[model samples]
Target: MLYDLIILGGGAAGIFAAINAKLTHPTANVLLLEKNAVLLTKVRISGGGRCNVTHACFEPKQLIKNYPRGEKELLGPFHVFGPADTIKWFESKGVLFKTEADGRIFPQTDQSETIIQALLQEAHGLAVLIKLTEHIEILENHASYFTLRTKKEIYQTTNLLLATGSSRQGYQWAEQLGHTIQKPVPSLFTFNVPASSLKHLSGVSIHPVRLQILGTKLFQEGPILITHFGFSGPAILKLSAWGSKYLHEQNYQTRLMINWVALSKEETFVKLQEAKTHFPHKTLLQKNLFDLPKNLWKTFLEILGISYKKRLIEISLQQLKNLAQKLTGDRYQVEGKTTHKQEFVTCGGVTLKEVDFKTMQSKICPRLFFAGEILDIDGITGGFNFQNAWTTGYIAGKSSL
Candidate 1:
């Protein structure tokens, strides 16, 4: 097949790139190749099917900070195109988005189908030829043209964009094409322990936990979940991302210290002291106004070997300190990691050094372009990753003309 531009991967970046390319060169034949039977598999399942469209933080500088992998390198690219533009682009497509308190934006319809339909609709309008079930196994560049060999056919194009993200196959293709790449690592995930406290609390969520890996500078905050196996939630997911290598080095065995209350020990200590002073006659076993789940609080106290039936006035200072330690510095053993639905990410693609961010074009292979998760430019969760898709995809799409 012959085309002006051939985009690999039918996901967010590739599809957006196709449409953007057509907008720049109306007559250019833009072909998008996807291996999956359906395009936007990640999009369909993202945010538990809601599809976090983009984050509310529209500023380029602030938006880039969310990324752990490509923050420094993305600064320049973001200045050219960022979250604000991402929101505007999607809004223009008729898929309205709204932000949550945590800055995660979801389709107002709360269905990922809406966002995918909008992309498919735009691609169709622009005459973008999409070929699903076509997996490109080889990408070779000769002079000013690029050739992509798939399982069934060989595709030739003047401009080529590789948006195949995360897959080692994608990384290999880029390395073969002479691009430096980062060694891929799992980013977002949850921890799995054999007999975790969260085993029975699958859906129990604690919002805004100040969590630290048992012995490191790494810590993160957001909502946390007690899964059937262990702990998950935005807090754990973000921590996993930020400390990917650290966790890997530790073999994921590092204990995680959580401030379940999310408040400083000093603050919580003061509150506890006030409670003890005022409620000296109160039974410790009874429920208190601390707002913690009763079962968890009771279990923690039990570990301290303190009987709940004991009167607050009768508790010794040593026991009081122990209770304080349990509340403010609870620790959990991390046995291993569990991938969060294939982590819905693209990293370790084409290296950043070889791509000109200004044009989203390859430096070594002229007339070849790159965008989205395929270029070692992955953003953190939120609309940041999606924004990368929009920006780089838009640039590659338009520049190919």
Candidate 2:
């Protein structure tokens, strides 16, 4: 069967594209192909199953900044269909999304299934054909139509949208079509600090802590989690995102400096001195001057070789200075990295320059479109990445006709 529009992925971008394409060209037949049996696997597990649909940021210019790779390219698409459009689109589909304090938007039910069901229902209602476990073995683009061959079937489409995000097969298909692909690498990962003092303090969370990748200007401040493997949290994830390319070049081995107390050295020392003077009889560990978790404070004290039972008054000037220094800048070697939960993202994909953002169509191939992580565009954690999916998918789907 010859389809008017064939989306080569069933992820967020593919599904969104298929729906929009069907809507824009009501008589056009849209088919969505997925290598996996399931559709929207990432959406099912996103945001801890809450499914971050889009970021709360509505401004188009500001929304483009979250993307590290395709910031400039996305600026054009985002202006056309940004976060506000995403919210409206989903809401119109009967899925009410709410934004969190951190600006991540999710359904009011707090279940990823809501978003998945909405997408599935919308696609089904629009008569968008969905075929699962259908892998494209070969793609042949002719002057009039593109032929996609699988083991058992030959499908042809006039408009082909490659929304296959980060899949190796997707890259292979783009390469076959004369598109340059960037080497894919891990992004939004957590550093594995084996000998970190916080290693034993698993389940302890600290907020407003600053993390800096040693030897680089990469820095982020937010909540941090001390896991058994190492550190995982918003701050570390953000740093991992910005430093993904550089750190990948470094072989995942780098030094990380942590500021348990997000305060200047002078300010930290003043607070410590005040604690010593005001609570002379209280033990340094018992006083908890930094508003840090009790276990974390004890771990730092142990690292500093200070007795937790020792009274603050008994601490000498040298020990006080050491504590302050450690609090402001504790360094650890990140020996490796771990996937930051199920929300793993790749930093590289199809080179962005080949695709026209205004229409999301390929410059090399007419009637060929691109969207989602398949492009070299990827955003940081939160809902920025999904917003990329919506913006590009909408443009590709609408303009493909």
Candidate 3:
């Protein structure tokens, strides 16, 4: 088969790119090839099926900061087609989106199928051919056109796009074509702490807690969860992305200091003094009184080995200091690491240095474009990953001619 464009992998980036490409030039023939029976599998599973379409942050610079690793490389991409453009495009398609208080953008209809249907419908209207279950095995880059060898047949196109997110086979394709693949690593995960105080306190969550992998400066906060495995949520996931190397270097056994309460040393110590002064005899586990979760209160008290039974009046000055220390800078051993599969993402692919963000085109291979998680850029949770799909797909579609 011969065409103007051939898009591999019919997920978020590939299909979206196909849709945009045909929209720009309705006469252009675009073929989207997928190895799966369905399209947008990742989009369907994302945000627990609601599909966080994009982040609420419309500013490109502010939006780029959310990505712990490819921020600098992502800046150019965002500045070109960022969050605002994504919202406009979706709204234009009759899918209105609303922002959660946390800044995640979801269709007011609250179904990923709605978003997928939008893409499918748009592509159908634009006459983009979606070839399912076709496995692309090789790419022959001639000076003029690109030939794609699939297990089933030979396909050729003037322009080609690879958006085969996270599949190692796709990485192999990029490497064979002169793209650098950063060693793949897990981007979102939960720390596995042993049977410590934080364990079994699983359901307890702090609204905003500091999570720092000891020996590294990486840290972030916001709704930290005490899971049966260890800890998770935005704070832990962001830190894991930033310090993935350091944590793995320590064999995931690094000590972590958590401030269950988002308080400074001064305020936290004063609060501890107030607790000691007023509820001198209350159990240390007494929670839901002032701070976030009460279970976290007990967990912190237990993690520090400070007996809550000690009478307030019986507590010595140094003991009060110790209590403050435990609450402010509690430390636990991270015995291991496990990707929070529920919100997991792959980091590192098709190194950004080799591709031009302005066009999502390979600097080494002309007429070949790239998009989606197959690139080294993966965003933090909060719809940034999907936004990358939108922006890169939009740009590639525009530049594909």
Candidate 4:
């Protein structure tokens, strides 16, 4: 059967495109194809199962800033259907969304299944045909219709929307269709410091710490979480997203300068001196002057070779200087990168310059469109990535019809 539009992939962007396409043009025959038996796998696993739907940033101007790669390309798309539109779209479909303090938006039910079911129900209501486990191995774009050949069958469509995300198959399709793939790389990952001093402090979190990639201007300041492997959290993920290309070129080996105190060198020194003066008899481990975690403070003292039992008054001037310097700026070597749970995002895809953001249609292929991670658009951690999916999906679907 010839379909009016065929959407590749059953992920967030594909599903959204199917629903919206059927919504705007109910008479059009739409088919969604996916290799996986289950649809919305990433959405189901996102936000640790809560499904971070989108961010709370309603303004398109501010929302675009979170994306390092497609900031300029997504401006027009976000202006048309930003986070607010995503919230309203889901809510109108009976799924209520709530925003957290960090600006991540999730279903009030806090279950990814809610989102999955809503999209599925909408697609069903719109009569969007879905075929699972149908991996298209070859796509032939004809002058009038596109031919999609899977292992088992061949389907034809007049219009096609490729939302295959970062899958190699998707990149191959884009390349075959005369588009350039930007060499996919991992984004929003955590730094892997195998021999990090803070490895022992797994599960410890430091707030408002400044992190700078040594030798580069890339930096981020936020809460940093110490894991068994190394560091993860807002700051590390932000830095990872912003420096993904640089780190990729360096073979994922780099050094980081962390400011645990988040203060100037002079301020850190003065603060340490003031603490020593006010609590002369107190041991170095007795108080966490920098408000750092108790265990982390103890670890720092031990690393400085300062005896935990050493009274503040007993600390020599040289030791004080060492403590202040370490507190303000400590260097750690990052040996590798690790994927963050449920937050894995790709840093590259089909070059954005080849697509028209106004309708998410490809300039190279008139009847073809792109959306989601399939484009060279990725955002930092939180709900920004999903928002990109919704924005592009909506436009691609609406305009494809």
Q: Model-by-model lDDT, in order?
A: 0.79, 0.89, 0.82, 0.91
* Superior by lDDT: candidate 1 or candidate 4: 4
Each candidate's clash count:
2, 0, 2, 0
Off by over 4 Å in 4: 340-343
Candidate 2 residue pairs that clash? none
What is the RMSD, in Å, between candidate 2 and the native fold over all Cα? 1.5
Estimate the TM-score of every prediction: 0.93, 0.96, 0.93, 0.97
lDDT of 3 by residue, 67-133 (tens): 8767898788888889998899888999988889999999998899999999899999888988899
Candidate 1 RMSD to the real structure: 2.1
Residues 234-340, candidate 1: write the lDDT tens digits.
88888887888788778888888888887776777776677688898886666364677777667777778888888888878778777777777888888998986
Higher-lDDT candidate among 1 and 3? 3
Model 2 lDDT, full chain set: 0.89
Query: Could you give me the TM-score of model 1 versus the true structure?
Result: 0.93
Error of 4 at 273 (Å): 1.5
Candidate no. 4 TM-score: 0.97
lDDT of 2 by residue, 231-307 (tens): 99888988988899999999999999999899998899998899989999999878888899887788788888999
Task: For candidate 3, give the lDDT of residue 225.
Answer: 81
